[model samples]
Target: MTAKFIVIEGLEGAGKSTAIALCQQFLTSQQIEFINVREPGGTPLAESLRDIVKAEHQESVASETELLLMYAARSQLVHNIIRPALAKGKWVLGDRHDLSSQAYQGGGRGIDRTTLQTLSAMVLKGLQPDLTIYLDIDPVIGLARAKGRGTLDRIEQEAVSFFERTRARYLELAESDERIKTVNANQDIAAVHRDITQVLEYFFQGLN
Candidate 1:
């Protein structure tokens, strides 16, 4: 089977890291070489952008500035890292991708969808994930889980309502896109992993 790009997406505390680890294990079992990538990161310049974007600042960050920074970081990762890795016959497991922008910037920040689409078209140039798994969770529960980890980042510091909007958008997009699957992250960790594994198994079977 050809190498495919897979993305794991969710709001804070949705267990994306654990899900990514599971994906790695699954790929390893299949003997498929893969690379794990985190959005707004995965490259030197992109990682720098990530730090800037996530850091809390004295001044309020404009929605436009936040949106542009996300795309800029994404452009660097896709062109410099993701595309190259895929070209070399390696699969990519992404922590987040364009969908995050749609949910966070568009839904949460109220950015216009047309602007996002234009930016995405310019930056991605038709590249897209072969499959995406969205771990769905309520903002209240997810934020509590995230807070338990450590200090919340700038984005994570957003109000619970912001995440509500974000989660709604995630579900909306997932329902519309067959390539994206939604897994209930409110369940126990093992159950979430089982659901993810089942989704991956179904996808891999289709590839045959």
Candidate 2:
């Protein structure tokens, strides 16, 4: 059987870690060999880039610089980790992937879509997630939750408008893509888990 690459995407505090745990549990119940990866930090080199990108810096980080760093990390993870694991028929569960770049850099940071498209094409070379689950939440509530967690990272410290743009872009992408599903994350944890499980169950059922 062919391996499947699944991605979980959401704004900050959208409960992605919990969702990933649930995914791992579900896959384990099915006896599916799988590996979990997080964007910008799956491999050693990528983790280094992730630190550079997220750290509070004295110098202003240009939007293009941020974009390039993201793609650089993604390229490294895709080539050295994701692809090789998939080739060995191990299911790959990603905490975030290209869609984060499209939403954060393209929409939130107001980067040109064409530039993003070019970078994606060049870096990904036609790879895509078999399924993407997007947990949708209002930026206000999401930010509050994120703040409660502790100090915010660089990207997480952006203005509310930035996250609003990112959330809008996420919804737009989910609407356009059949393989992408949106879950209302504003709901309670139990409700969100149920919705996510339903989506995963439906997908796995179709696979059978």
For all predicted structures, in order, the TM-scores are: 0.99, 0.99
**Tens-digit per-residue lDDT, 85-119, candidate 1:** 99999999999999999999989999999999999
TM match of model 2 to true structure: 0.99
Question: CA shift at 159, candidate 2, in angstroms?
Answer: 0.6
**Candidate 1 Cα errors over 4 Å, as ranges:** none
Q: Each candidate: what lDDT?
A: 0.95, 0.96
Best by lDDT: 2
Clashes of 1: 0
Model 1 scores worst on lDDT over the 10 consecutive residues at 36-45
RMSD of each: 0.6, 0.6
